[model samples]
Target chain A: MRNIFIIFKRELKSYFNNPLAYVLIIIFSLLSMGLTFVIGDFLKMNDASLTSFFFFHPWIYMIFGPAIGMRLWSEEHRMGTTELLLTMPISAWQAIVGKFLAACVVLAAALLSTISIVFTVYYLGKPDGQMIVSGYIGSFLVGASSIAITCAISAFTRNQISCLLVAVAVCFVLVLAGFPRVTEFLRPNFPALADIGNSVSFWWHQSEMARGIIRLQSPVYLLSLIGFSLYLTGVIIRGKRS
Target chain B: MIDIANLTKHFGPKVAVDNLSLSVQKGQVLGFLGPNGAGKSTAMRMITGYLPPTSGSIVIGGIDMLEDPNAAKALIGYLPESAPLYQDMTVEGFLSFAAELRGLDGQRRRDAVGNALATCFLEGVRRQSIDTLSKGYRHRTCLAQAIIHDPEVLILDEPTDGLDPNQKDVVRNLIRHMGKTKAIIFSTHILEEVEACCTRAVIIDRGKVVADGTPDHLKRHAARAGSVTVRFQNAPGGLRQDLEKLKYGARLEAVETAGSTLSAVVYPKTKADASNLSAEIYELARSRNLALSELHEEPGRLDEMFRELTSQNKV
Candidate 1:
């Protein structure tokens, strides 16, 4: 555990030391705010609830999460620091978890910085505080899943571009799996296939939490996905050592 | 403190390191000498527990590397080839990170980092980011990271490679000082490093140990051991045959003539008696009225011996 935190602190500090972190925060803020007002009809509804703001989260996270997480292992592998890190006394699991937590720290900050949107909705009218908290929680979980997937894919290859492309493609499929149109299309021919897609989809659970319905299954599902991806990342790292 | 037996590594069908064995006790600096692609780096990697061998065993301080690598790895400090480093980190921050990874804590960690920085001459650029430093400073920073914990076993792969002469001397002197307490093994293609710093050397070729001995012992294995060259100004027709038929003729292994000079190498026939035929050869030349221009015995040449030993072709 001590070793994990040591790696965690170094990785987290490195994120802030580079210009990419600030650039990512700006891009995420712009996309999230833009999708809510320009496309979700924020002003026309005049609603105090941030339903439209939270609606674009799954898509917004898919882009920003991978962009931030692509460098987690790819940079280390490309620079050959993977050799140094693995040969250290720390276990492979510790390195993977520490790097994952570091990415989560950056993701949390990027998500939390858009609280101005929450302030705007609050000032205009009375918004449901319960739903806002639940929405933030759901967004954090979704962002974590995306980052975990990115980290895992990054371990297989050293190129950041390849990691980003594969992560975006994989996450895109997960997002599309739960889309009502896709599930609706599948149900006519294959009900069992549609059920599986609905069960595995990030949007399927994220939307429920966005509606302020905090089910136990939702957190378990997202947590399991993160755990599995992190485990696979550890396997890839240990494979590289031999 | 390090023992490797029958260490072999194969990359698919190709063998990178053949069956080889060696051991290094405490207070010994073993210079790993070989040409490029001779498996020096691969052997060091296996010893450090970074790469698992195909079929072998590595025991570091009595800890089986294959069984419990972490304990064995904890006792070693390795500087890999090229000295890879985190470029964004400052020298002080990097050393502290290394110390923490090595399990040092609190005041001890601070002191270890400080000591490494001072030892590697990194105090002046301790606050500078690694990417911003010059190559020499960067190399020094990498060296500092390796020794931050001061482990008992040090495996350095080409520690002074790519450095200028002054930097090379500093690193070599540092290695010599540290070798007093640690079991150190450093690989290099430079022959002079073996003589200057290493207490013993193992010359490897193609994946095997071709020769292992002290510098002086290996140098004495040269083909020209106790050989003498006699350059004559006025030649005598039967000088070569006359020199071969002298009283110590049995000691003369071979005699060859180049231009006006006749050189002969003597391999002592008996262990205790190495006949000095130089005096006898001069007397014979004087009796025969031949003018002697140069007559001197040559010590063995290490470079020539090294070439001759490693260049043997495999059947």
Candidate 2:
């Protein structure tokens, strides 16, 4: 556990020390704020919920999350540091968890910067702040899910492009799986498949949270997703070290 | 403190290490010598618990590597061949992270990092980002990270590979100093380094050990039947007979015509006997009215031992 924290601290510090992180966070904040105020209002239907702000997160994280995760294990493997890490006193699991947590912390910081949208909506209209809070909760769950999957995908290849492409493709399917159109098409043709898809989709579970309903099932879904991704990452890291 | 038995690693159809087994005593500086692609790195990785062996067992400091890798790894400090490091981290930060990973904390971690830096001569670069440092400094950083926890066994794969002459000397001296107390295993192709630093070595080629001994022990094993070259101006036949008759408790094989000179292998049963036999041959050549133009000993070097070991085992 201490080893994991050590790795986590190092990985998190890498973000601040490396210059590329400044550009990424700046771009991330501008996009989240701009899309929430400028673009969400353009597409608003006068709803008193923070549905606009939460909706843009999945799309935003699809790009940013993968970019943040692409370097986690891929760079270690590329630089041959995987041996150094594996041979250290720490186990493979500790390092993976540490790195995952580091990426999560950095992603959380980036996510927190978008709170300006919350304040903007709070003052601009009589929005249900509870629903907005839940909606942010849902946004966080989705980000966690995507980042977990991205970290797993990043381990499959050393090239950042392949890591990003795989992460985006996997997250894209999960993001769209619960959409009404996707469920409608599969409902009659393959009802069981649709049922399975709806259960796994990010939005299907996220919708309840967006409306200020914190279903026990929502956290479970996100936790399970993150856990499974972390397990897969463990396997990849073990395979790589061998 | 280290025991390995039948260690093997396979990558698909190719075998990286083939039933390799060896042991190292406490405070023994064991040099791992091999040609490229000869399983030296693979063996080191398996012992360090970085890579699992396809078959066989590694027991380091009384802990089984496969059974409990964490405890086994806890006993080892490994410096990989390329010395992988985080470019964004400073020397202090990198070593602190390594020390913490090894289960140190607070003042202990700080002191361990400081001591490691001193061992690797990295005090000046403590605050410098590893990327901004020279290759030698980066290499020392790698070495320091490995030993930060002060493990009983230290495995280094080409620890001094990229350093210049002076930096090499520093690392060599450090290893020599460290080896006085801990078990050390290091790999390098530089035979002179092995000769200068190691107590014993295992020369491997094509995934098998061909020679294992001290430097002089290996040199003696690889020496061809000690040869004595006799360049004569006249009477080659008489010289040959005279040389053949003067064998006193030594086995001499005479080559009749070796490049316009009669070259013969004076196979003294022992290398210690070869020196005395050379003078005996010189007198014989002189007594026969033959000008002993050239009478010299064969080239026996540590490198020759390495080549002979590797070349013969090449698959």
Candidate 3:
């Protein structure tokens, strides 16, 4: 536990030291808010809830999560610091968990930066505070899940650009799995395929939480996705030494 | 404090490190020497627990590395080849991070970082990011990270690889000083470093141990180790024939003749004859009324010994 915290502190400090993190946060904030206002038609919806605001989160997180997580293990391997860090007195699992949490915190910060939208909803009318909190929670989980997948992919390669490309490709498929058009097409010809798509889709679970319906299955699915990806990261790192 | 036995690593069909075994006790510095692709770095990685061996065991400070790596690793300070470090961190920040990872904290962590900075002469760049430092400074910063916890065992791979001459001298002196209390194993391609800091030297070839002994003992294996060189002025005509016919002299070659001055070298018949060959030549020069300018037995050269041991054509 102590070793994990030490690694986490160093990783977080490194993120802040680089200008990439600030740029990512600013871009994520502008894109999410801009999409919410322009495309979602925030004022014309005539609803006090932040349904329009939470709608664009999965698409925005698909790009920004990999942007932040691409450097986690890829930089370590590129700079040859994997040997230095692995030879230290900490276990590989500790290092993986530490870096994963640090990147998740960066994602969390990007998610939190859109809290002003919640205030805008409250000022216009009496918005459901519990629903707004649930929406933020659900959005943060989607971002965390995206970062975790990217972190796992980053462990497989030393090139950050390759890591980002592969991760975005994977996340794009996940986002498309349960899109309305795809699901509508699959539901008629292949009902079973549509069910599997919804089961693994990031949009499916996130939209459930956005509606303030905290079903046990949605949080459980997202948490397990995060857990499985991190476990895969540990496996890849251990495989490198052998 | 480090004992490795039957260590081997095979990458696909090619064997990297093969059945290598060596040990280092407290107060002993073992110099690891090998030609390129001889598996020196691979063996060090196995010992440091960065890479697991295919079939072997590494015991550091009496702790088995494979079974309990964290405990074993805690006692070791390793500097990998080329001195890899976090380039984005300040020197002090990196050292402190290393100290913290080693379980030091608060005042102890501060003291460890300070001592490492002073020891490696990194005080000038304490606040500077590692990317801005020169190669020599970057190398020393990694070295400082290795020694931050003052570990009981130190494994350094080519610690002075890219340093300038003065920096190399300082690093060599530091290694010599630190070897007194810690078990140290460092790999280097430079032959002089064996004599400078190592108490024992091991040379490997094709992933196998070829020579293991004191530097002087290994040097004695050189082809020309026991030969005697003699210089004379106004020497007699049959000097080469006379020197060749001596009882202990195996062969004699006249090296140079400029004007009335001549220099010749006599090879000994056996290792035991080297000590007496020089005296025999001096006595011969005295009796023949020859002016003997210089006569001395040649010590073996480490570079020659290294080349001979690691040469690919050796049977």
Candidate 4:
């Protein structure tokens, strides 16, 4: 546990030390803010709820999550630092969790910085505080799972561009699985596949939490996604230990 | 202390290290000598518990690396061939991170980082980010990170590879200082490094150890254990044949002429009996009433021995 914190602190410091962290945050903020105001007509809605802001998180993270996770292991392998890291006393699991949680902290900070949107909604009208909090929680989980998937793919290849492309493609599929058009299209020809897609979709579970439902299974489903992705990442990293 | 036995590593159908075995005791600086692709780095990785061997055992400080990697690794400080480093980190920060990863905390971590900085002469650039430093400084930073914990066993692969002459000397001195109390195994293709600091040396070729001994012992493996060179005032005809027939306690392996000078190299039947060949040659020249211009014996050459032992085309 202590070793994990040591790695986590180093990784977190590295993110802030590099220009990538600020660049990622700026891109995420611009895209999310732009999607909410321009596309969702957030200001014209006149409603206090941040539905537009919360709705764009999956798409925003699809770009920024891979941006953050692409360098997690790919850069290590490329720079030969993997040899230094694996030879240390810490286990592979500690290194994985440390890097993962450090990335989560960065995502959390970016997400929390959008509290200005909450303030705007509050000043305009009375918003359901419960739904807004639940929406933030859902967005956080979705962002974490996206980062996990990106990290898993990053571990398999030393090229950061390849990692980003493959992660974006897979996340696109996972995101589309929950869309109404994809589900409706699959329902007529592939009923079982459609059911599986809907059940495993990121948006399907996130929507329940965004609506303030807070079902036990929704968080469980997201947690399982995180666990499964991280497990696969661990396996891939262990496969090339030292 | 480190003990490795029958270590073998295979990348699919290709073998990297083949049935390699060696032991490094405390206070021993074993120089691992090999050309590129000779499995020097692979063997070091296995000894440090980073790579699992295909079939072998590594015992570090009495802890088997395969069975208990963490404990074994805790005792080892490794500097890989590339001097792996995070370029974004400052020297102090990176060394501190390494110290923390080695389980040091608070004041202990501070002291370890400080000691490493002082030892590696990195105090001036401790606050400088690694990427901005010169290549020599980056190499020193990597060395500092490796010794931050002061482990009992040190496995360094090509530690002084990219450094200038001064930096190389500093690193060599540091290795010699550390070798007093720790078991250190460093690999380098540079022959001078083995002669300069290594108490014992192992020359590996094609994943197997071809020779292992002290510097002098390995030097004697040269084709000519020792030689006597004499420049005669008068260039005698058939001088080469006469020198070869002198019956010096050892066989005259080669007699050559260079600019009216004659030099004959003698090889003892065994390395132990190479004592009086030069003296015998001098007495023979005196008895023949041949006034000598120059009479000197050349000890074995390490580079020649290395080339001969590790030559790739040897049968």
Using DockQ as the measure, the top candidate is 3
- Index of the highest-lDDT prediction: 3
Runs in model 1 with CA error above 4 Å? B230-239, B246-297
Indicate the residue-level lDDT of A130 in model 1.
Answer: 99
Worst 10 residues of 2 chain A by lDDT: A42-51
* Candidate lDDT (C-alpha), each: 0.87, 0.83, 0.92, 0.86
In model 1 chain B, which range of ten residues has the least summed lDDT? B266-275
| Tens digit per residue, CA lDDT, model 3, B1-315 | 999999999998999999999999999999999998899999999999999999988999999999999999999999999799898999999999999999998999999999999999999999999999999999999999999999999999999999999999999999999999999999999999999899999999989999999998888889989999999898767776787899899987767878888898889999679989988888898888899999989789999999888886855
Q: Which ten residues in a row have the lowest lDDT in candidate 3 chain B?
A: B235-244
Looking at model 3, residue A27 earns an lDDT score of 95
- Candidate 2 ranges with C-alpha deviation above 4 Å: A42-45, B228-241, B248-265, B269-299, B313-315
* lDDT, candidate 1, A1-242, per-residue tens: 99899999999999999999988988888888899999999879988888888888888877887998999999998988888887787788899999999999998888878889999998999999999999899989999999999999999988999999999988888888887999999999999999888878877778888889899988999999999999999888877656
Worst 10-residue lDDT window, candidate 1 chain A: A233-242
Q: To one decimal place, how large is model 3's interface RMSD in Å?
A: 0.6
Reference-based TM-score of each model: 0.92, 0.90, 0.98, 0.95
TM-score (chain A) of candidate 1? 0.97
RMSD of each: 3.0, 3.4, 1.4, 2.3
Supply DockQ values for each candidate: 0.74, 0.76, 0.90, 0.74
Candidate 3 docking band: high
Ranking by DockQ: 3, 2, 4, 1
TM-score of chain B only, all predictions? 0.85, 0.84, 0.96, 0.91
Flag the better candidate by DockQ, 3 or 4.
Answer: 3
lDDT of 2 by residue, A200-228 (tens): 98877777787788889888988999999
